[model samples]
Target: MPYATSAAFAHDWPDTVRLVTVEGAPHTGAWNADAYAYAYAYAKELAAFLAQHT
Candidate 1:
């Protein structure tokens, strides 16, 4: 999990925030995963979040 300090954006702006945290994922891991498992893992959730929010 990321440290609380990493959530400055959400902390500063609680409203209108859509935070996504992937445990143990390296920087840019979501977009750069070899098998794209990280990206795929959250694809549906992200899509749903976007659909509801947007």
Candidate 2:
């Protein structure tokens, strides 16, 4: 989704939502081999989020 839309959605739950945006990243960019950094960051973020929530 677009950044604006994502921000808006996060706005609805300001206290609980954590929005992480990767510049110039496509929807599936994190899965691409060319996007290793983004993928690593995504995985790290996801792990942190899950750890916090669980």
User: For each candidate, what TM-score against the reference?
Assistant: 0.47, 0.62
In model 2, the clashing pairs are none
Each prediction's number of clashing residue pairs: 0, 0
Candidate 1, number of clashes: 0
Q: Largest lDDT belongs to which candidate?
A: 2
lDDT per residue for candidate 1 within 1-54, as digits (tens), equals: 444654776778877565666666564564554446666757876898889879
- Write down the RMSD of candidate 2 (Cα, Å): 2.6
Q: Give the winner by TM-score.
A: 2
The superposed Cα distance between candidate 2 and the true structure at residue 15, in angstroms, equals: 2.2
Deviating ranges (above 4 Å) for candidate 2: 26-34
